[model samples]
Target: MIVGLTGGIGSGKTTVLNFFKAFQNISVYIADEEAKNLMNSSPLLKSQLINAFGKELFVDNTLQRAYLSNLVFKDPKKLQILNEIVHPQVAKHFSEFVALNAHKAYILYENAILFETQNNQFCDCILTVSAPLEDRISRIIHRDQTTRRAVLDRMQHQFPEEKKRLQSNYLIQNTSLPALKEEVYRIHNILTL
Candidate 1:
């Protein structure tokens, strides 16, 4: 089964993914991380980005991530356009990943915007991780060294936690590591069965 693992910024999806990784039968695909890799390594993607955004977005054959992040997070249209450019390639890559991992009992495809991108339709089930808004803001501020305002701005682009939770097959409230590990194990057992 392909399980879509998703959450908003700073909601601890990565932590949950790590817990899932401990299971021998589970294979993981991190969409956002793979998108970053594709953006840098794929010539076709590089040309598309430069054509749409500008050549300056890529400096010395590397994407100017800070510049791109600042631009996209500040503008919804730009963010949408960027997603348009990257998501299809990621989806194709993800399909290949699933085929390669077909021997596994479960494949966890993790993305922050799984619902937003309509990728949930491709999933057998979705697990949405959530945390209190204040906790999420604090986590992003510390991890990314960005201000609360900046984190909030990024969060604005995602569907509300409540909406995601309502749509998901499973929900994990991530407040503490011990509790989270317990929850992950519980869910893992259910998914594997």
Candidate 2:
């Protein structure tokens, strides 16, 4: 079975993903990391990004992430256009990854925008990690070394927690790592059953 794991920014999704990685016979595909690699390496993506943004968006043939982030965060339409260019490639990469692991009992497709892109529909089950807004903002501020306003601004772009929670088959509240690990094991058992 394929499970789609998702959460808003700073929602402790990565921590839970790590917990899953500890188990046997499970494969994890992280879409954001794959997308970043594709943006930097794919000739098609490179030319398209340069055309859509500008030459300055690349430095040493690699994407200038800060510049791209600023561009997309400032304009929602540009973000959509960027997603248009990248999501399909990421999806294709995911399909290949899934095929490679077809014999496994379980695989995870981890993405921050799983619900946003309706990719959750492809999963056998959906898991949404969540944390209180204040905690999430604090985590992002410390982890990204960004201002509260900036973190909150990014969070505003995500689907609300209540809405995402409603769409998920399981909700993992990540207030503490030990508790979260216990929840992960519980979910693993349930899925294997």
Candidate 3:
């Protein structure tokens, strides 16, 4: 089973992936992290990013993430364009990851935009993690060292939690760690059985 794991920024999707990893019965493929790696490693992606964001955005074959983020967050159109440039590649790599892990009882393909990009088509089921909006904003502000407005700006480009909640086959409320772990384990048993 391939479970599409997703949540908004600061919603702790990665943390939830860790909890799922405890089962030792699944493999994880984090799309955003893979996209970053592709941005640095893939010549085609590097050229496209340079064309879209400017050549100065990369240094020593690595993306200057902060600089690129500033431009994209300021303009919704720019963010959409960047996503357009990267998502297809990420989706392609995600498919390969699934194929390699085909023997696993379950695999977790974690991406923040699973539903938005219609990547859910690749999933056997979808799990959406969520928390209160203020909590999400605060978490992102602390983790990204950005202002509330900036976090809100990025959130603006994402699908709303309520809508994701409706779409998910399973939902993790994510108010606390124990509950989150318990839910993950429960789902693991369900999937494995």
lDDT agreement with native, every candidate: 0.93, 0.92, 0.89
Report the lDDT tens digits of candidate 3 across residue range 1-193. Answer: 8899999988989889898877676898888899999998999999999999898999888899999989987887898899899999988898788889888988898989888888888888999998888889999899888899989888887899899989899999889999999998898888888
Question: Which residue pairs show backbone clashes in model 1?
Answer: none
- Total clashing residue pairs per candidate? 0, 0, 0
Over the stretch 63-178, how does candidate 1's per-residue lDDT look in tens digits?
99989999899988999899999999999999999999999998999999999999999999999999988989999999999998899899999999999999999999998999
Better of 1 and 3 by TM-score: 1
Model 3 lDDT at residue 119: 87
What is the model-wide C-alpha lDDT for candidate 1?
Answer: 0.93
Greater TM-score among 2 and 3 belongs to: 2
Query: Please, what are the lDDT tens digits per residue for candidate 2 over residues 5-45?
Result: 99999999999999999988889999999999999999999
* Model 1 clash number: 0
- Runs of candidate 3 with Cα error greater than 4 angstroms are none
Candidate 3, 159: how far from true, in Å? 0.5
TM-score of each: 0.97, 0.98, 0.96
Worst window of 10 by summed lDDT in candidate 1: 184-193
Ranking by lDDT: 1, 2, 3
lDDT: which candidate is best? 1
